[model samples]
Every structure is written in C-alpha cells, then in structure tokens.
Target: MSAQIKNGTILLAEPFMLDPNFKRSTVLVVEHNPEGSLGFIMNRRVNMRVDALAKEFPEFDAPVYFGGPVGTDTVHYLHRKGDLLEGSDEVMEGIFWGGNYEKLRFLIDQKLITPYDIRFFVGYSGWSDSQLQEELEGGSWVTARMDPNYLFKSDPEKLWSQVMENKGDTFSVIASMREEPSYN
Candidate 1:
C-alpha cells in the first residue's frame, strides 16, 4: 500500500471502473491497517432521511447516503462536531466519524448539529487484508488528500469530478470526460 493512502485518505474510483457500487464514487478512508481497510462512499446519496431508518431516531432532515456495499444493516455517521460530540474519531483534521448515538440525537434535538454539520450513511466500503493494496496497485483507485470542506461545504453530486479536477494534470483531463462517452 502506498504510504499516502491511509486513515482519512480520499479514494476516487477511476473514471471507468465498472463496479456498480463504486463507479465514480468518492470514498473517505476511515481506517486502514494490516488487517484491512474501511471507508465510506462519500458521493452515493440515497433518497431518504435518517429519521426514516429508525423509530428512535429524532425527526431530522439529514439525508442518508449509501456508504458502500457492505453492512447494509448498519448505520454510520460523519460529522464536523469533533469538539462537541463525544467519542467521535477524527478521520482527518476537522472531520470526525462515529460518536455517541444518544448524544447525537440529543444534539440534533437541541438544533446544535445541523444537517450541514453531519452526514448519515448506511453500510460502508471495506477490504480484506491486502485487498485494498492490491486494488490500489491495479489502478482501480486514485488517491487524494482529505479536505473537510469536501464533506461539509461541497456538493456530493459533483465530489468525484471535483476532486479529480483538483488533482490537476492528467487527472484534470480525466475529470472532464463524460461519464458515458459516445464515439461517432
């Protein structure tokens, strides 16, 4: 595995990847170790809200996202409230993943955590030992530095292309290609 790829790294699926679950997806690495790697697909938003997933969840407008193809029965979260949310693991400088669930609900109830301050996800992207290394070596993914704004300030709809373009050089050109090109 490249030293650059680690916890909090951003993995951009190669533009032509064929996997339905990851094609054009922007993934945020939450953990990477000798055992394996795990991340959340940052760009695959689902047409639902967090409140719809559980009866106990407070009524909120936070959109739910398809984190990846693994653990569909689970729910996870990323937030910018590292200072205020207890038990949050910092994925990067200003981004935190997972925290006290009851505290989260309480914060939401008090309007202390806004939808813009957090994102809810279902499932997660994961790889077995050396699986992610093999995938990275095979050119299936491109790495980028994580920026908190990408999650809290930017639009998920354009995250893949936006990150690709930000990489500059050949990546900028790749970012400009149409998702489905037609050669006439």
Candidate 2:
C-alpha cells in the first residue's frame, strides 16, 4: 500500500458514500496486518447506554456505540487506561483497545477507570485482505492521523464534518457540501 495505513489510522468516510453502514462514519483502525483489518466506528453512537445492555457492567453513564455492522452481538472497547487494564493493546501513543475482560471489570469496580477513560462499542468494522486497500484506492475513505480528541470529545453528530474540516482544503470544501444535493 502506498499509504502508511496502520494502527490508529482514522478512516473518514467519503462525504457522499451510499453504504448505509458507513456513510459519513469515522472509523478508528485498531488492527491492520496482512490478513485483514479491524476497527470501530468512533462517531456512530447508538441510542442505548452501556449499562442497559449488560447488567454485569459497573454502573456508569457512558453510552454504547455502534462500532460497525459486523459482530453486532459482541462487545469491544477503546480506552486510555493503557497498562492499567491488563492485556490492553496500544493502538497508538495513548489509545488502547481490548484486554482481559475480567480484569477490566475489577479495575472499574475499584474506581480506577472512569467513564472518561474508556469507550464501549457493540461491534467493529472489518476488512478482508486487500479490501481496505481497494476501498482506499476507490476513494471511499479519506485517511487521517487518528486524533484522540475526535474520539473522546467531539460531538458525535459533528465528528465526520469536524474531521473533514480539520483536514483544511479540499476536505474542508467537501465537508461543507450538503448531505444530499439535488442535481435536477
């Protein structure tokens, strides 16, 4: 791949993408290798909270996000807890994803990890070998350096446009386009 697509790369969906699953989605790539790639949609928060989906989870007001279309029945998480959560893989300088689940609960119960330290998701995006490369070549996604603030702080509804505008130039122009412009 000509582009340095790697862990922590943020894949911004092209403005007029038609795929309902990822239209205007901002995906944070957590794993990318020869076999395939895995990531979570960072901006597509579902209308449900995490505790509503799991009684075992510690009491927290955080919402559960729609990570992607695949593995909708499963759960995943991204965090800034680092080694504090055993087995958590560092996706970049500061972000981590997944780890020993039971240990995570233990840390949460101990008041070591707060809602701001982690974000949960119901599923994740996946790409087969060469699939993502093909999509990148086709312009379905605009790759950007993953920014933690975009994932942790930006308003979910404004994330796609915010990231696009931050790109500053062609991307900003694209960000300003109407979601559905009539040509007739």
Candidate 3:
C-alpha cells in the first residue's frame, strides 16, 4: 500500500471486485498499523434501524449499515460529534469512531444526535498485517483521501462513485463504468 493509505484514508473496492461482501463498496479506514487494518464499509446500508437491532438503544431512527463480514454481532459507529461526545477517537479532522455507548444513548434521547450526525455499523472489515498492502498491489482496492462530508453528507447508494469521481483522472472514468461489465 502507498504510505498515504493509512488511518482516515478511504478504500474504494476496485470497480469489478467479485467478493459479495465488498463488491461496489466504499470503506473508511479508521485504524491501520503494522499489526492489521480496521475499517467500515461506508455504502452498504442494512434494512434495519438502530432501535430495531438493539433493544436497549434509544428509539432513534438511524439506519444501520452492513459494516463488513467480520464480527457481525458487534456494533460500531462513526460520527461528527467528537466535540460533544466523550471517548471519541478522531478518525480525521472532524470525524470520530467509537465513543461511550451510554453517553451515545443519552445524547440520542436528548435529541442531540441526529441521524445525519452519525452512522451505525454491525461489523467491520479487517485485514491481517500486510494483507491490505498485498490487495492494493494486486489491484483489489484503490485509495482515496477521506472527506468528512463523504461520511455525513453523501448518499450511501452513490458514495462509491462519488468518491471515485472525486479522486479524478482515470478514477473518474472508472466511476462511470457499469458495476458489472456487459461482456457484450
């Protein structure tokens, strides 16, 4: 992987990826190290809401996303509320990952956290040490700089193409290709 591909970087799965878990997905790398890499797929929304998945969670209407194929029973979150949410690790200048869950509920109950301010995930994408680097070298993924807006303001259905186009150059062309080639 390029040196620039690290924490807070965005990983766009190559346009033609065949893996059911990641095909056409855009992922946000929240942690990267020599040990391993951890991220959430930014574009795969689940058909359920936060309250529907967790009985203890406050009755907020935030849609949950299919984070990845690993640890599917766990819950995670990314948000723009670092300033007000305690224990939030800054993934980038304005984005945060994982914070106090009780506090999160309180904030939601208090009407302080809007659905637009946060995203919930049911699992994460992980790569063993050097695994992601190998994938990059093999053309399974492409890197893009993370924009806070991509998480909070963009539509999940269009995030992959949106980020690809924003990457410019050849990537912009890649963004326009059909998800699956016609083969005609």
Candidate 4:
C-alpha cells in the first residue's frame, strides 16, 4: 500500500463490507491526498432523466447518478474531454474530473457531449487518506487501473459485475456467489 490511490483507479468493495451503500460496489477514485479521498459510486443510478435535470438547471444538461450517501447537494462530474477545461485533472489516461462549468454548459448546449459522455453525481464518497489505505490493506477494496471506457458505460447496472468478472476467474467466482449464501 506504499503507492497512493489516485484519480481513475477503480476501488472494488470486498465481500464483507456490510455498508449497504458500498457493498459489492465499484467506485472510481477521483481524488486522493493526505487530507482525504473522494470518489463516485459507479453502479448506482438515480431514476432521474437528463432532460429533467436540464430543465431544472437549464444552464447545464447531464445524466445524474447516486454518487454515494454523502453530500447529496454537491455536484460532481466525470468526463473524457477533461483536458479541454481548466481545473480538470486526469484521473486516468482518457478520463478526468472537475472542469469548468461554463465549458460543460457549452458542450451540452452544442450537443457535443451527451449524457453518456459524462456522468453527473450528487455528492461523493469520501475517506480520509489513512482510512482508505487502511481499507485497502484490510481487503475491503481491490484497486485496479481504470480505462475511460468503464466510466462511460452505457449500462451502469452491469458495470460492477463486469468489472469484477474482468479481474479473472477468482473474481468471477466471487461475482457469481449469492449475496447471502444458502446452506443446504
């Protein structure tokens, strides 16, 4: 765990992580440092439509997601065109986070970007840096390098299972296991 977890890394929750919000979840770590860590849950989707959000915040149009149970009022976005905007930081090679709001608005208005091109999250999942490292060591999370393709997945509901399956046969076995095992 000597290496620091940074943006774009995928965090897979361990089988025993009982927190209902995070169990069997895959998260994209968007920020990390000594101060704390921040990320969004990749598998949770809110029923809200992009057009609905666009109507509410006519200045911006994007897809919405359940980031986590934390700060539900704050908005965060993950994007592939992140480099084009100031303050955007590359989470992985083709993915980034935190960019200019005006630029986002322009992209949305021009139809240059679609809801599938970026994900909007309300609030975010956070962990103190030490806490995250501890969780990693405890086998509460499996860290993997991220690919931008995973972030813009068309079917987020299947993203978690797909990621776990990609990890290999061992993880595949885990993915197939029932949440609550039955005794015959």
- Write down the lDDT of every candidate, Cα atoms only: 0.92, 0.89, 0.92, 0.77
lDDT of 3 by residue, 28-110 (tens): 99999889999999999999999999879888989999999999999999999988889999988989998998899999999
Task: Kindly list the per-residue Cα lDDT of model 1 for residues 1-184, writing each as its tens digit.
Answer: 5646789899999888999999999999999888999999999999999999967988899999999999999999999998989999998888999999899999999999999999989999999998888898899999999899998888899999999999999999999888875631
lDDT of 4 by residue, 1-184 (tens): 5445876788988766799999878899888878989899987888775556543354444558888888987778888787566778887787878798777777777877777678888779999749988888878898766777777854687777778878887888776666675621
Residue pairs with backbone atoms closer than 3 Å in model 4 (clashes): none
Off by over 4 Å in 3: 1-3
- lDDT, model 2, position 126: 100
Clashes of each: 0, 0, 0, 0
Model 1 Cα RMSD, Å?
Answer: 1.4
State the TM-score for model 3. 0.96
Candidates 1 and 4 compared: the better one by TM-score is 1
Better of 2 and 3 by TM-score: 3
